[model samples]
Target chain A: MHHGPAAELGKDYSIEYKTRLGVILFFIYLLVYAGFVFIGVFYPDLMGITALAGLNLAFVYGMGLIVLAIIMGLVYNYFCTRHEDKMNKEAEL
Target chain B: MIYTVSPSAIVIFVIFVLSVLGLSFYFARKSKSASGYYAAGGNIHWFVNGIAFAGDYLSAASFLGICGMIAFFGYDGFLYSIGFLAGWVVALFIVAEPLKRMGKYTFADALDAKFDSRAIKLTAAISTLVVSIFYLIPQMVGAGALVTPLLGFPHWVGVVLVGSIVIFIVATAGMTSTTYVQFIKGGLLIVFSTILTIYVLNNGIKLTPNEDYHKFQTIPVVMEQDKILEIESDSYHLKTQHTEGGVTFVSLDNQGIETWWSLNRSGSEPFLEEALSIVTTADGEKLYNGAPKTDGRFYQVGHASKIIRNGQEVTETGPLGPFEFIEAIENTDVTRFLKKVFEVDGNKVTVFYQTITPGKDIMKPGLYYKLGDKGNLWSRLDFLSLMLALFLGTAALPHILIRYYTVASQRAARKSTIVAIASIGLFYILTLYMGAGAMFNGGLDMESSNMSAPLLAKTFGIVLFSIISAIAFATILGTVSGLIVASSGAVAHDLMDKYMKIKMTENQKVNAGRISAVVVGIFAIILGIIFKDQNVSFLVGLAFAIAASSNLPAILMLLFWKKTTSRGISVAIMVGMISSVLIILLSPTMYEIYGLKASDAPIPLQNPGIISIPLGFITLVLISLMTKKHRATK
Candidate 1:
């Protein structure tokens, strides 16, 4: 089982950095997504209010969560790529 | 229930299946080594893999189930979409990069990478098999649903057809062909769904009554509770019914077929005292709820019962923007069918009577979620558990997790996941419009909610319906293939090679995988046939619950916690898989499957995620503490 270091496989990165940002963003996303579930389950009446056009709060909030997921994904990708690259460059030096 | 076969749909469907088989044969020769067969030699492009992620992830549940749910009930079905899409975030940000860097063939590879232990392999492999089998059921069920209208085949034939095709796909090039099929179908599904949606929007909301159909008058007659009385109608007596051994059996007319009606004691659904319906078609043929003795007519199943425009009742509303369209519908009247079995002329008849539901009520919550049920703890927990399972299940699904291993690098995995999220998110948005459009399309099949989307496309024309059903069929093929490939890898690589320590030749490994694919394929087909008429949405929910509870905890713990021992991971995986499967079998849904009363179920909730998932986490933590001596010795 002994060969080159396992880090060479691209698994080595700043665990602290990734976990910190990942947990933070994860909680933020869960909070928003959970909000959608809670409102629908508990406050059924609020979802009926046609928020805009014929789109009710139910539709708006759900769509918002979906759109937010994309935005959050792009955000995470950007920061994580930059952070990982910086770590790899430092590791090379 | 007599769904006439669309010849055009059959032609297109056959062509699609043939092309997919051709692609598989070509890829089969291209792949040589076991590595090549299992993971495509890790050479897949990020973009293709990303789209394939969407393809495999969407499954029949996303396409058929959500759309059908929305068409029947309202926006409540879209909640499943939000939960499913949100799961990819956990995949992309947390699981994808780490998994790709560590694992080779299966999800078990990642778990066992940290500790060279047989327990991890055995447990993870078992989890993969259980989850994949559960997932395969809905895809098979969906295949049957699509074939009923398109190919004019019975549901079981459709199940077997998909099973055989998916087995051939996996047994050939394994992941190589599976990825390409997913990529092609994933792209086609979105493109065609968009085109169908655009056509629906262009046509706008229109009230077009069925040429042959006529509404029945509800004559409320006072009758004795236990006495059998005859309420005569024009054509024939309603279908007869009798209660024997606590099961209410509605004996259909010589021409009528059996259909599952939601058996509930709660009078939430509508019922009439005198059930009378006599639908006389233009050709002087007698019909029951718009179906004849011979070839039945497609009744106006999902039409808006009433439409209001600018405070006035109007039959036609011209083309409107997406938001405006929903707004118009909110204030309008949607005539949705509510089914109830009643005695007429001493015969029990199950009539799907039209109810003019307020558009506002349809547009809001509580249609399917029962959100207003404050007193029911089980209802609240069940709803939350289903959403939780869907949210967590995506990251844990064996078919989905293996896609990361097909790519070259961790970054590729993350990028691919992001692509998947974008594509899947857009498709879900389109599903809302499609579902609502189908709801009032006046062409939906009431008996099979899974047929809602394809039947809606039928209204556009034969070509559109054919293409939609064909794409849906391909969607099932792609998903089932990916699942079979995953299960095969678990059997050949993880369980046999790693845990059993077979040390077989490369050729033998590939042979083992092929054999497992066929066996699993046959098993899936039998299950598909047994649970023929199950709603795809509910079946998919069970699959998600099992996957989330079993696989997610093990993967998350191994990645985040240093003290996570091999014993802990194995225990967590086994406990999660077993408890979830046990809870599912004991749940109310299973009680229904047992042909027993819902009240007979020992478990209050149908979903097992809330109970089993936390139980998995607790077991892992406890076991890890007990086995912490190994960590300290190291």
Candidate 2:
């Protein structure tokens, strides 16, 4: 039937590698995100610290999490695209 | 109070609605098959679908409710904003591409991919409906709140109006029309909100109270001698005055004592004054309860009571930078208005008073949580649970997940989600400014926080008010249409086509979906009117809780864990959905809804994600392990 490489599900070498990268990025994002939440809940007074330009720590940190999501998304996309190209090239070879 | 019905607003609103209806009608012809109806034939441009993602997601809860919370309370509302955006992390990294690769049309298609079990289909369909309806109520409520001020229409008028229109949109051409509606509204919402934020910055923070504010706040009282001589405030003369104890005399409004009145009565129990109220009727008549009429409709509510510019209290600070605005506001005193509704002189009157709070206090958390109350522990827990629900729910919502199928491939799905995140994140950042702008400006309404953003625009001009309100209405239509599409797809695609194996031609399938959309749209309208008073953001939090608890565990297990059985998936779905709803229903907040004391409720916390989500995961793992051997033999 000629099911493609992407359809192999959990066993294809390239797909497994991409999945690993996704897991890593997910953890990195979660660690910072959860830290911001915990700090907000437990040490709320810390959020009051005007760490930058009259903006409180909470303000800066909350914004940091949002920006981080975009950055992580870009990095994942770049590497996955590169890897997909490589796998396709190898298949042709 | 800043709201007034504008001819221009009515014009813009009609134009906006007619164009949306036009788009839906055009798409109706393009939706030829079941696939075309359900997913726009999976040929949508990734970029278009990406913006459409933003349109589908930024519901009334995000726009009106979050903005209102920030305006009325402060930074706590941004907590919801951040939590909601952070959820895309899960969606992008894990769910997006894989979900696209697996699912054909409905979300149930993805979950039922491996086992192809009717149990999974039925449970998933039921879960989709419950979550969709839960989410729909808030959007409808937000629509109702907007209608009253925009057109002087009653709440039900708005509810039924939006309900009927959205049903028509969905029934005509399911996803094609739904996507276009979302895309146009999504793009317009961001653009208009940005313009509003920019206008707020240019205006800066003005300390000018309404002209009638002083007259209403300060009542003149005349005292003749040491004996009870005379008292007149709000037209009530001295009934009788006496010195009860060793107290000599006190003056109200001593320029320092923080309260509204100063009396020169002797004793711990100084003579109490008659209550004053200010009510604005539905007919634009402003009645100072027990007093004369004031032509003003809305007095400024949340504003910097005192602004210190260059070490002196200033009348106005004009044109500050975005960073400078927040800093200057933090250094000032803000007047937070409180409203009280009571029966007086055989009439229902509402009174609003300004409480002076430090600006630093306004810019921080703990305002919304009420940490000082007897239910302090529960309130804190509930707060955490809400954040969790919002964070998890983004990856779990059926409408959101189904968007992946509208695009071409796994790669397209991933790229489109990233695009959605960028635009949506920028919009959320703008929300903080918009919320603060309304708060510091005089357009806040304590009784209806949902009016904050639109009311703020009215303060700028009637034209901007009309346009912003019209866009806000479109935002409701877009989100509701998307939710209805997802629900109808679940019913027709999963329940009818797959589970029941009802062999219908492409034409028949589209018909079934149209029927489902009509039924669900009506249900949404009724629920919306019933929950008219709840803050839309809070209702959205409950919806997130249900999605996080029910759908997330099953989807995550199915994709990653090979041992996950169909039985486990069904059990987990039922448990996650039912337990979350049951807990939410029994919580103190629901008890209050039932007209019972919060203290008398069975549970303390208002949020259900903390318990129900973990139970979903635990059930999935345990049930999967037990059913593994049986599945292997089969």
Which candidate has the top score in DockQ? Answer: 1
For model 1, the superposed segments whose C-alpha errors exceed 4 Å read A1-16, A88-93, B209-293, B297-300, B341-349, B373-375, B630-634
Candidate 1 per-residue C-alpha lDDT over B1-634 given as tens digits, one digit per residue, 9 for 90 to 100:
5666767777898899899999999999977778778888788999999899888988899899889998888877888888889998888778887787778889988878878778888999999999999999999999998887788778899999999999999998899999999999999999998998887787777676344333433322223453224333343343454543343333223244322221122254322332223344345555554456344533546666578888888887878777777787787788777655444444444556455678888877777766655436778788889888988888899999988878887777789999999999999988888888888776556667888788778888889989999999989999999999999999998888988889788888999999999999999999999887777988988888888888898889888888888888899889999999999999877888888877899997888999999999999888998898544122
lDDT of 2 by residue, A46-83 (tens): 77789897788877888888888888888998888788
Candidate 2 regions exceeding 4 Å error are: A1-13, B1-3, B209-216, B220-300, B339-352, B371-375, B629-634
lDDT of model 1 at position B138? 92
Q: Which digits, one per residue and each the tens of the lDDT, describe model 2 over residues B227-314?
A: 5454444444433222323322222322221122224243443353322345444555555432333333344456676898778889
Q: Can you give the lDDT of residue B521 in candidate 1?
A: 99
> What lDDT does candidate 2 reach at residue B569?
89
Q: Residue A34: error of model 2 in Å?
A: 1.4
